[model samples]
Target: MTAQHAAAGQLQLNYWAEARLQRWGHIAVPLSSTRVAIHGGYGRDGKKLRRLDDVVIVSSDGTVAPTVSSTPRPKARERHGAAAVEGGFVIHGGRAGGAFGDAWRWHDDVWRELRCEGSPPAPRWSHAFVALPGDACLVCGGRGDAGDLDDDAYVLDPATQTWSRVAAPAFPVAFACSTSDGQTIAFGGGRAARFADAAWSELALDDATAAASRRLAACVCATARPGELVVAGGVPADEGEVGGVAVLRIGEDVKCVAEAPLDVMRAYPVHAAAAFSGDGVVVFGGGVPCLSFAPVFGDSVRVVMT
Candidate 1:
């Protein structure tokens, strides 16, 4: 891992952590106090796995520590999808040896089970989900059994403990980076079908009603911001990753404004995570070459848009 300073007086970019198998699966989350939280398993010497049950907190003022502990951790299960919401973070829909469709929330120093009814999403892994500004969450397609892709779309209302079916414009794709800009939900590149094709989709919410209009083609990653959905680095095929950052803004049609204009091209399986910080955006750890089952990059890069 290495450290480099970016731009003027922005945050110091630290990329000093080596990649391990268990560490690669961790996800980066930004805290309310301008710090970052990383949760996962880390490999110490390729021989032992360090459980990342604790949330690592890093601040710009040069403070770092673990906020929570895994000693008395929640139920042991692989986390595939996560989103930071009103109270805390909600983890959903991961697979172990079999598919998992359960939802758990991490808030107030404890993990609580969240139940819903009315046709829940099928047990799936690598499915994409995002919490909207309101009490709504949208989950999309992912890989199912026998290497088949799922095309189901479900909306969970935490306030009502109910689930409802939503229209799926993009079908048969897993590992897509699905996120929202408060109003519209966008999904971008992943293993589309069995052949490893690349594509994108989106759902726009009306100003008055919170109903999603339809799915559109404006792929983005977890690193996207509100109103601005950007695809930093993703795989064009199953073989390798691309360095180009495909960018799109939410408007009348949700069109692509730029492509690969950034300084870096992301590697494959780059499960990038980001959050809004202050006036700009804060992007956390991501993987390379392919979707890493463990955490790879351990840097906190702060992005301030012009």
Candidate 2:
């Protein structure tokens, strides 16, 4: 839990703690200013992948403890999308052997699966599921049964518990990472992470380092300040390197937090989870140390802010 003091305007990725399991693709939800809850992820078992089933709580001091539910829990999963709102935490779509379309909410200390009205989105994984303006959420493009889906975004209106498809081109693209202050959202990434509302336009990012900041499945969180975001580990477009933490402001150039990106940061945390709590953003477990038959897993817990 130790940290080096950073310059006033620069944000640094400080090592927070070594998590219990070296897992990746987990969901991290900020329970409060001082607490974060970690859910399922994938861990390596020899040459195979094992789905983790542990629920742990992490304190600001870097202590870890396992937690369990009195009621039934959702089937162990990874690469799932979750949104932490005022009332509860909503999670959807992930794979455990196959893709899942189930929607579950965490409330009253239990994992309760939601029975939605109308049909749900196709069971898919590696997609974007984000919390929007209201309590409703948005789900878009992921790898579906037939293969990579086209740009069809689905909105889950909690009021009706039904899903309606949104035909915004900005979506699915924006869906990759949506940063909001609960009033508006900023979307699109790579090369030049654009701030778009409903329209889609490609921005050529020529900087290799900047372009790779937060690619597919990178963790994102809106900072305490409006229009500022912290981006962390993911597979970069160039796929040059595997680790780094950078800051992206709507109208400013991307800024790398530290002189050495991986000096204090975790590597290749493609589907790592992030939550904005207190004055910084906490990043949990991520992996893909190497894209080989026997891949390495991660057990990293770090935080950064700008």
Candidate 3:
């Protein structure tokens, strides 16, 4: 694996060898400055299919260890959205036996269900979520029960333990990637087997992109620099299940500053995860490319330097 500096302040990714065992559909949330917490996903334990419930902590130096939580654990589910909040990490809406509207918070080695006032978004999975300013989060678009896809949006204030619906998007999307750079939240990608709308909406800017567009089912993270978003590991509409990555500068003009191919091909509806490190981003497990029944999971981690 090698890293090369790129033009436009974009970081070239160095693909490392597979460092962890194969797993996908897991959620990775930053637990502290140097640790990331990985939650449930499906993988193989021996010859049988396994739905995992263990909490694994990944250290800054690339160490993966299990954490024993003193409190109750959330249900084992995949395609969940997780983000670090004020007091802890909040995970919301994933598919277990079916879509879920329940939310849980993990803090101080404990897991607690978050019962919010008013209504929350409908039961869904594969939604896009980003940490908003002031200890809040915005969740938008996901596949609902019975194959229903939604365009709705909602905001959660962990401080108040409340949820409020925001204006829905102009077009429905799911399994899309999203990231926030303090001031703006940008989303891309859409459902599998379809091209995402060419335009993406920026919540804070109250604007959408006009010329730049690509269908992606990737994981995304913000760089240390403002107004920069990095998207990694997803299939493009034209590329089928091939893995692709890109960096977007969301400013006066929203455009892709850099683009490249992932070390391997991946598919959509795969629950991949990303977290920003000191000066780069780390992407975790995603579903391997498939053309038939059942998906082969990926066990590697890729780092993109910014």
Candidate 4:
């Protein structure tokens, strides 16, 4: 594990590690204090892309294990979104041959397809799905069927299995990452998402450094401290699409953490999965070698406070 000095907010990058046979565009969410569950991704090891037919659980000790679901789960998918909720993780909208509009939940050792009463969000991939307070969920912006980015948002009430349009402006991005503290949510990719109001009300900018970042693509992020997030690994707009490990702050100003970026011991880590565990943020699984279509294996990188 390579170590770096702490600078920005006094939080140091603990070390870099390898990732597990996950492929590109999979969904990942925290399962426990030291482990995260990764599901559904595709690979093009040769030429044609296909779904990876399995679920993987990654532990902080750098161990990767196959998850044996006692109940049947959804078919292999890619570029979908998953959020940790009260009982289990809720997954929604992604693609294999084409984009999907279905939603499912993993609970009680079972997988159940969620049938929305009315028209749910249109078929999409890489949208942001997050758990909200009261166990509700918010769905927003993603690449839609017509190959256009969506500009709408909706909230799902788990109790009623109903969808309500959020009375606020939607996130202007797709393929971004989002996390919530049951009160505030932080999201973004090419741009930063708001995280302050418990209602996810329109956010007020910190006027700090959220304005300093260039639009990034395929970036992953996790909420760290309250009102703070740790963002890493994205392709900058003008950088010829090469992935890098630059650390970015989304909510408040760029404060703690080292000034240097964190990188993987293996893959280039674009389109990776991220979740906060203990004092550190764990980044794992993605298109290895960056733009190249390769699978991730072994240990995953962890960025922790010193």
Better of 1 and 2 by TM-score: 2
- The best candidate by lDDT is 2
Off by over 4 Å in 1: 1-22, 30-33, 41-47, 50-52, 60-62, 69-79, 172-181, 188-226, 256-269, 288-300
Error of 2 at 77 (Å): 0.9
How many times do residue backbones clash in model 4? Answer: 6
TM-scores of the models, in the order given: 0.67, 0.80, 0.81, 0.78
Q: Model 2: residues >4 Å from true position, as ranges?
A: 1-9, 44-49, 170-180, 183-210, 251-260, 264-267, 289-295, 299-301
Root-mean-square deviation of every model: 7.9, 4.1, 5.4, 4.2
User: lDDT scores for all predictions?
Assistant: 0.48, 0.63, 0.63, 0.59
Clashes of each: 16, 2, 0, 6
lDDT of 4 by residue, 205-275 (tens): 44223332333435455555554455556555556443434444444434323334444445445666677
Which portions of model 4 miss their true places by more than 4 Å?
1-11, 14-22, 43-49, 168-171, 174-180, 183-208, 211-216, 241-258, 288-299
Q: Evaluate candidate 1 by giving its C-alpha RMSD to the native, one decimal.
A: 7.9
Candidate 1 vs candidate 2: the lDDT winner is 2
By summed lDDT, the worst window of 10 consecutive residues in model 4 runs over 206-215
Q: Show the lowest summed lDDT stretch of 10 residues, model 2.
A: 251-260
Model 3 TM-score is 0.81
